[model samples]
Target chain A: MNSSSSGNVGIVIVSHSPKIAEGAADMVRQMVGNAVPLAWTGGDIDGGLGTNVAGILEAIETAWSPAGVAVLVDLGGAETNSEMAVEMLPEDRRARVVVCNAPVVEGAVIAATESSGGSPLAAVKRSAEEFYA
Target chain B: MHDAHASRPGETPVPLTASAVLVNKVGLHARPSIKLTQCAKGFTAKIELALAADGPWTDAKSPVKVMRVKAPQGATLHFRVAGPDGKAALAAVLALVHDGFGEV
Candidate 1:
């Protein structure tokens, strides 16, 4: 886990399928290189098709950026789990985290690129949300 | 010639515009869109990308808007840039497009 530098927002991808999350993160990495901090968690502790709150929490912690962190989930359940993971963080840390309402692959790519450019948390979240617009 | 003489200091720099075809196999999909958006952000100029040469431009700085063009292979992408660095921006973007985004 690389430490996130100041002014760089991080990205976390959550998905029911480990392949989906990992693949999306890989695509983002290829596009933005190491300019942004990124982490991801998918599947359950048993390696089944489900979201794991603990895994999500660890991903967020590993990719924690002082600028902020954006989480992109694949489905509603994953979104809920991601939200719960955020809630488990210290109050101050939780405030800087956002569970974005956007598609996993597209949102991760856009958010990662936006973060690489040193945009604020709000702008990064906006970039992901723009996928829906 | 006449336009150059008519322009005065403090006035806005003339916009640099160009059009190029999407030669990459995938067109402006995720990879290229991400690259294009990141490149656009590198410059301070205002950049717009449109599917047609005439109008209806979208901010090139936005990945979603760039992808919204939904341009397939062989489609033309028009770029309009304005600001002090518009020429550089236009040239860089055109070079990237002509390079087939490193595709082939």
Candidate 2:
């Protein structure tokens, strides 16, 4: 929500419902404070590509570049969409992305919020490790 | 059968075996803990976490019991099931833990 942090990795949360994406981001903000960059793809973003493979690719091109991005998504469309995005990512950059398994909103928030101070890849790995542990 | 066992009353009884793995990440957060406790509530079993030998094992069926434990990543937990379906229940839980609650 806050665009002030310039160098941090961009985290995108996708859900069928915009409200849910907001809720997930909000939870993360509450825990670590608003010091990370966040964007939403599924909720209110124009074009159906927000949660789709194209949308993820666009977000990567637009936001991740110098710093890679991490994505957390809800169930249903969000899940399949993340998987598709993974397939589309270039093999070299694939390591930069991660899909969390926190169970919809909870997982997204945990992944996005925890993605600060460390490498975006590390944050995402930690989230995945925690969720699966 | 009763007479045979009674003849050896002084002998120690064999302990029952049960095992469960740590399923939830973040080491058993409230939501998953509640879910596990609710599942344990259905039947009567002496459920307890196999904490470090020095640490006391807590009841698995109690939400509070699970909350007290701060299990981290890759930690394997054990459950003591003793009831009608103790063996079956333990087996199911073992499978769930092995699967990492469907996440892994």
Q: Return the number of clashes found in candidate 1.
A: 0
| DockQ, candidate no. 2 | 0.02
State in Å the error of residue A74, model 1: 1.8
Candidate 2 residue-wise lDDT at B61: 58
The residue-by-residue lDDT of candidate 1 on A10-46, one tens digit each, is: 9999999999999988888887778888898899899
lDDT of 2 by residue, A76-122 (tens): 67777777887788898777776666565555544444345434566
- TM-scores, all candidates, are 0.88, 0.46
Worst lDDT window (10 residues) for model 1 chain B? B5-14
CAPRI band for model 2? incorrect
